[model samples]
Target: MTRLGDGVRLAVGTLTAVPVPAPRQIDRAVAGVAMALGPFAALPLAAAAGLIVLGGAAIGLPAPAVAALALGAVALGSRGLHLDGLADTADGLGASYDRAKALDVMRRGDSGPTGIATLVLVLLVQFGALTGAISAGHGAAAAVVAVLCGRCVLSLCCAKGVPSARPEGLGATVAQSVPRAVAALVFVVAAGLATLAPGLPWWRGLLAVAVGYAAAALVLARCVQRIGGITGDVLGGCVEAAVAGALLATA
Candidate 1:
């Protein structure tokens, strides 16, 4: 639990220019904590809840506007973990040949052409899905459910057995600390609760999980093969891709 607090500090540090503490220090300190409840995944779920509560007022707004606001809240809250991951993963995968080079590319902290293309494509897909869902009268429930369940996928990915490319990297800590069973429980419970809301069918929410899992398996498998295993950035990418995929599927 305390580690989660440390993870929170790390997350806060990443988002803001504020220097609270060393990220690697906080990362190590929060290893157990992050394992317990999920890290960046938790924040997006929280943001989704806020979006759901605000949906009544948001309903009148354009789908893109509402989605932008909600995504803005998530980006602000988590400090762009997913976006950065999305970028890094794109750059690395596009530029690298094998595990070592991919991991090296990801560590460069600079976006490449692939990263730019990925960012643009995902944004278009996300906004388009949001617009379609809202137009179809499912945005409020679908987006909320997708966000939470996407985090469920994040937790699940952390729990899976995958070798880290580098012994000292973020993936190593997460892979070692997170228990698959605990992560599974988080996914099941969160998805169940999110489904219990008034406007949505429970089956639809469960379907979102199915969609997420399928996507995660495919993406993470490639990630593991290409980079030797997952990292904080990959985890962030997983959440974003899963959530967006779920929203589009459920829509």
Candidate 2:
């Protein structure tokens, strides 16, 4: 029980900017819990996003602007970790067919053309889909669902058998850490939660969850093909893609 408690704290600390105390001990068991609990740990972020959408709509802000602001808030909440990861992953994938060169490109701080282009395309898609959801009065629910789905996909990415591309960093700590059963359970829970979100039918919720899972899987498969395994950047990219897919389905 203590280990599980510590694991929860670790998940919150890692997944958010929340200043929780460090875990007393860290191991594969703890890492698995942390990744598996990512979606629940993201509850605060999800609530903030939903509230932002609700408040923005109430104040008559344009849906597009409202969604942009909410997404900005989401990015800030996570310290822009996943967004940067997405860009880096894209740059890495597009950099070179050679694995070492691709990984080297991703390690650099600067955004290259591929990174810039990917970010633009993803941000535009997220913005457009979110804008539609807001205009349809499902903004808050959609926002919450999208955020949860994003984090939920992280568990799947880290589930057992998903190898880490590199031997170190965040990827090394978390890669293949989660039990496949746990990952599946987390995703199922996310889908169930989505079903209860207002203004979204159970069918749509299921569809959104399915699409999110599919998107994450595709990203993972590509990462494995390109770099031999998953990495922190790839996991981050998966989160963004999952969120975009979930929002699109919701809209």
Candidate 3:
């Protein structure tokens, strides 16, 4: 496969449950492209979410139930990857003051009290915000935007200058791989296109984008402060937080 093809496969394979051939080689360039295209790579999940919203709306399903279904699809589609990341990051954050101990806690597969609590809180907020948006008649738009938000922030997280918390693993491979300009361009395009959402005010769309990215930034800042840099888990936390922010803003 060509290098760009390798990047696409890497993005889809890692970001979603969809099976794709793993890249034969991984380097900074390939990793950068993968992160840059992360949002597009997740088109399947985003489209599934948007379709679920439309279908539920047509059937006059309860908004909350519809929202749950959409989110459940997203979680399953991605193999609950971000959810696992969010939980691990939370556990690490709440584990100890020592960086090594915190890292070790995150490395463990088990979820602790802090991780479980964090998951509950985040999932509740995500569901509530999406339900509200669906009720407001922007169900499809909200679903698509929220799902896109989850992946689009990957570029920003991997932008050049962001340090990896560890010397090895997925985080290290993609960390600092995206150029600042490329990340900014992708973000701008996503925000600019939000005006196309049905019945959504252009200003509101822009604000939603800003709010979503801002939420991701806040999570990233905290992770950096706590862990000295980001791990794969921290990136996952950012995605969930960004999704919630977008849904809340739309609602």
Candidate 4:
């Protein structure tokens, strides 16, 4: 039970900008447990964003403005980790088809034209979809569901059968750390929660979950094929893309 608490603390510390103290030690087992709790760690981020949306709506703010603010809140809460990953992945994929070269590009601390373009397009899509959802009276629910699905992809990416791109770093530490059964259970729970989100029918939420899963799967397959395995960047890209896909489905 103490170990479980530590794992949850680690997940909250690493995955969000929350000021939780880090555990004294983090090993493979702890990281695996943390990865399994990824979706739960995202609750604060989702809640912050949801509050922004609800508050903005109560004040007669435009849907676009509300959505942009909500996105800002989420970005701040998560410290833009996923967005950074998305950019790196794009730069890697755009630089070359060769696995080695792509990995090298992703490792560099710079954004290229492709990365910039990808970020712009993805943010635009998310903003537009969020605005539409808010206008349709589903702002808070959409925000929560989208953020939760984004974090849920981390578990899927780390599930057994997925390989790490490198032998070190976060990607390797958590790679294949989650069992397939656990991943499936997390997915089902995420879908169930989505179904209960405000202002949406259960079927719509389920459809959104399906879209999120499809988006994550596509990203995962492409990363495996191009980079030889999953990297931290790939995981990050999956989260952002999954969120966009979920919001779009809800819209």
Of 1 and 3, the candidate ahead on TM-score is 3
Candidate 4 backbone collisions, by pair = none
Q: Give one digit per residue, the lDDT tens place, for model 3 in 1-251.
A: 47789899899998999988889888989999999998898889989998999999999999999999999999999999999999999999999988899989999969999999999999998899889888998878887887887788999999998999899878899999999999999899889887777768887777777888999999998888888788889989999989989888998
The C-alpha TM-scores of every prediction are 0.82, 0.97, 0.97, 0.98
How many angstroms is residue 73 displaced in model 4 relative to the true structure, after the best TM-score fit?
Answer: 0.7
Write down the lDDT of every candidate, Cα atoms only. 0.68, 0.90, 0.89, 0.89
Model 4 C-alpha lDDT per residue in residues 167-221, reported as the tens digit of each score: 8878998889888898999899999988988888998898888898889889899
RMSD of each: 3.5, 1.0, 1.1, 1.0
For candidate 3, the lDDT comes to: 0.89
lDDT of 4 at 215: 93
Q: Give the TM-score of candidate 2.
A: 0.97
Clashing pairs in 2: none
Number of backbone clashes in candidate 2: 0
Model 3 TM-score is 0.97
lDDT of 2 by residue, 1-251 (tens): 97798889989988889889999988878989988989878999999999999999888999999999999999999989888999999999998999999999888857899998998899898999999999988989888998989999988999999998999878888888999999989988888878888888888888888898898899899999989888888988999999999999988
Residue 186 shift from truth in candidate 4, angstroms: 0.3
